[model samples]
Target: MNAIRIDIENVTVAYHGKVALHSASLQLQAGTICGLVGMNGAGKSTLFKAIMGFVQPAGGRILINGLPIRRVQKSSLVAYVPQSEEVDWNFPVSVHDVVMMGRYGYMNLLRIPRLSDQRAVREALERVEMWQMRDRQIGELSGGQKKRTFFARALAQQGKVLLLDEPFAGVDIKTEKMMIHLLMELRQTGHTILISTHDLASITTFCDQVVLINRTILAYGNTSEVFTAENLSRTFGGSVGDFSLATSQLAPGNQEEQEWT
Candidate 1:
């Protein structure tokens, strides 16, 4: 359970010659749900991109299961659920089609879905309770449904590592609960999950580990130890959302100063 699933060492990512993330490093263990918590433009997405092989780090190294991301991509060992805004809702595609796309790695040059691919897609949709809506247009679903459909796509890929970006951002409470439950189940099956989130209050609820980031990593480790008010305040540079710092760790005046929505 403690095996290192993702290894990042002294990584730095830049866009168009502008530094976005610098010297960020983290080692995520298998069978764990780690929360990547930070404020807006905190480079959480950039780090995820770097791990997914979307953007290469200008320096340092990132390894998934001791191999590079390119190899991982070829084996479908890592599945990604991007932020909602990153997708175009107007795209003409069905839920089933999107889920089947995950199996493309397993398909031949013509991209024909074999019997196993079809079965896997169906199983994935059922796992997310979206089988009934598989034929529905992807854009016609609710926010929660969209998230689930995409998550199902990831599952269909049979990846060992799952990187979900802002999964709880625009979903309802029911969707949030369902997603959390599914994630817990995956952890039990030895899947490593890294979730990038801005909702600080929810990090400790489900995460076994927490990473506090503001461009570079501020603090990271066991959630109970690293998700402290002091570290969080430092990460956010102030209070954010409906969060109140605990008095036992910080002075009352500091606590008051750190509490805000």
Candidate 2:
């Protein structure tokens, strides 16, 4: 059996008396890609924050590699890429500099990067095909380029797990494909990844597992098993009939059939 990389046990989160998540639980295996699917306010981001230790859970716990989240975080076992809207695009930093920030976790108080850090940053940028634009200001790059730069930063971190929120948003199709390919390669390299996205059509195509959440976990399992019409309807609060019709029209017939099969 594959070792579990992430384990969320009956976690709950709330703010100002409004419960964002209630008794949510999930488990992700090592070296696999899991897609988080849910509506806009279904507490997907809250769950990510809880696992990252940015938000304290009101109940239960989260474990990484059988250790507490805080312990895992201290070892730089996880990296996160937040939603694009949360970023300050106008920040005056070069692409290379932004990527180098990933190495800060290993740096001292002076924040000076070492030779090894520089080599890792260069390799990450080259892997993402962004090395040539290393000196360009972040604000001047196209949306796709900006996304790639952030991805390169995550790669430079060399974390065992990656959590990405809407990594495909606002990018062209080509860039989206590139990101997906990179994620798959990362999984093959024994890196566990969890991505929150609304692109339902790509779930079966790339993800090894799918998690459906709506204030809590509605379904979690292999992509081919949990992405059923019934589970999707529960997550989206739509009728299964409506979901099937919509999916049939929006996705390729074979893809839709695979999701249901």
Candidate 3:
């Protein structure tokens, strides 16, 4: 049987008395691509944060590799690619520099990059096909290239698990395909991947498993079974009759908003 990479049992999170996630439990198995799906205010990112130890839950437990998340900095076991919009695109840094930062977790307080660290960074860049553009200023790269650079940064961590938030949002088709291929390769190599996205088409076809979140976990399992019209309607506050119509109303500037899924 595949080992469970992450397990959340009866977890709940709240902010200023407003509940974000309610008694949510989930299990992410090794070597699988699981997608978190739901509309805004669905509490997907909050669930990720809880698993990453960024926020402590008010109840229940989160475990990573059979260890309590609070005892270990879960960041070392799982890599995170936060939403692109969460990053400052104007930051004055090179692609290589950003990728090398992933080594900080292994470094001491002095945090000097060693030869092995540089090699890992280089290999990570190569893995993402961004080695040639390593010296370019981060701000000068295209949106897709920038996303791949961060992805390389996460790869440099060499963790057993990966988590990405809206990775395919606002990218060219070629870059999207490249990212998907890389994710598939990661899965083949025994790494567990959990991605949160609202792209129902990709969820329907690309993902091995689907999880619907809306202030709670509505459904989770194989995509064919969990992404039903009934479940989508329950989690999305409406039917899947016209996902694009509802999504269009919130697309233009909604990227910058603090939404769940």
Steric clash count of candidate 1: 1
Q: Which pairs, if any, clash in model 3?
A: none
lDDT of 2 by residue, 1-261 (tens): 134488899999987677888999888778899999877777878888888988788999998878888776765678898776667889889999999999999899887999999999999999889999999999889888888999999999988889998787678888899999999998888888999877787778999999999899999999999989889888878775654454454332222212211
Worst 10 residues of 2 by lDDT: 252-261
User: What's each prediction's TM-score?
Assistant: 0.89, 0.90, 0.91
User: Model 1: clashing residue pairs?
Assistant: 241-261
Tell how far residue 215 is off in model 1, in angstroms. Answer: 0.7
Off by over 4 Å in 3: 1-4, 242-250, 253-261
List model 3 lDDT by residue over 44-95, tens digit each: 7888898888888999999887888666563466788988878887888999
> Compared with the true structure, what per-residue lDDT tens digits does model 1 show for residues 79-112?
8998776688879999999999999999999999
Whole-model lDDT, candidate 2? 0.84
- Each candidate: RMSD to true structure? 6.4, 6.4, 2.5
Instruction: List clash counts for every candidate, in order.
Output: 1, 0, 0
Better of 2 and 3 by TM-score: 3
